[model samples]
Target: METRIDEIGPGIYRLSTYVADIAPPAGFTFNQFLLLGDEPLLFHTGLRRMFPGIHAAMARVMDPARLRWITFGHVEADECGAMNEWLRVAPQAQVAHGRTGCFVSLNDLADRAPRPLADGETIDLGNGKRVSYLDTPHVPHGWEAGLFFEESSGTLLCGDLFTQLGNGSTLTDGDIVGPAIAAEDMFRSSSLNPNMGATIRRLADLQPQRLALMHGPSFEGDAAAALMALAADYDQRLKAA
Candidate 1:
């Protein structure tokens, strides 16, 4: 497994690790988005087993221990698996999650106390970057799930929403929706929560230009339109289920 880091946006880097044949017919990627700000933030911790590679990737940008906030969209191996490892290395780093995630799981699992953000709350990331946490619990998977939108750069740190299945790229401006839908169909990983579609629609309101996904390329350009369309499709599928 090899890893690399790409600056997708100003002060925003996508650290990706790719492994071949992990998903049977295709390779897969585990990504972490790092926001370089007065208070540096790391989104998604890759997997617990991949800590070595993920940590090395962080070194390319700055010292891993300099991280101030470690956050995720949900409670999953690929989301917070290396949380404690990060807490160990970055002594000042605190786990940030939604209120539910903090109370239900993070409070108990995290090595340090978690900073719980309220729904629609904004955390100042310095350098004019403000991160808003959209509570999208059960829309994707975890009861504590949520996504981050960096206002300055319009980058939606959407974990596992538009996950593609292959040895992924660092970034893409094409129709990521098509491949993401196919991957969702094959994996059937989204939550069956009835409000899932509505949750997705909320993201459209943000009008994000870049969607930094967890398992694939960070989508660049017109993310709001793409997401709204996907929301409609998800509405139908979820209703059928």
Candidate 2:
């Protein structure tokens, strides 16, 4: 498993391509993000089976023990299945989730209770870095799904929004409309849940500078506009349906 880490913007970093293989849809190689704020936040931990790789990657960039928050869009195997492993490494780090996705406790995981994060909630990373969480109920495949947008860096840690058809290589969308169209088509054609359009509209209002989708490449610049365009497209598709 090869991991490539890149600094997308000031204090925003992405770890992509967990493995080189592309077979079986390669579900574990999803994008993992690290936000360098006062207390570093790890977003979207990989599958439980990849803990060794995940730990190695964290050690390469940061002291695995210093992670302060473990966050994800929803509770799933690829997204937060490594929470127990994370607690093993960073004993002090808190596992954050939305109200609807709350779990009582994983027996072997850390003793820290899950923190319920709500929509419009802002995580204040001291030294001027801050991220706001937007509740996206069905954008991905989770009922308690949500997206995180960093205010200072203009990066959105979108979960499974712009998933592409390839290994987790470097795939970024710079063109405003290209990725927007792709994401819109994907959700409308593939998604079975409602409220995606509404979620997109709310995300557009954030006006992010980067669209950091979990599955595919991260789109830089005018994240809000891109989200709005995708939302509008999905809205149209829904209307026609």
lDDT of 2: 0.72
For candidate 1, give the lDDT of residue 46.
82
TM-score of each: 0.97, 0.84
Error of 2 at 120 (Å): 1.0
lDDT of 2 by residue, 1-241 (tens): 6667777777677777544454344443477888876689989888887777767866787888988888888767888888878877887798777766664333224356777778888888776788787777767566777778888877888887755544534545565456436544644423544687777777777677787777677777667777777676667666778
Q: Which pairs clash in model 1?
A: none
Model 2 stretches with alpha carbons more than 4 Å out? 18-29, 103-111, 167-194
Cα error, candidate 2, residue 161 (Å): 0.8
Count of clashing residue pairs in every prediction:
0, 1
For model 1 the TM-score comes to: 0.97
Deviation from truth (RMSD, Å), model 1:
1.0
Query: How many angstroms is residue 187 displaced in model 2 relative to the true structure, after the best TM-score fit?
Result: 9.1
Give all candidate RMSDs, comma-separated.
Answer: 1.0, 3.3
What's the lDDT for all of these models? Answer: 0.89, 0.72
Clashes of 1: 0
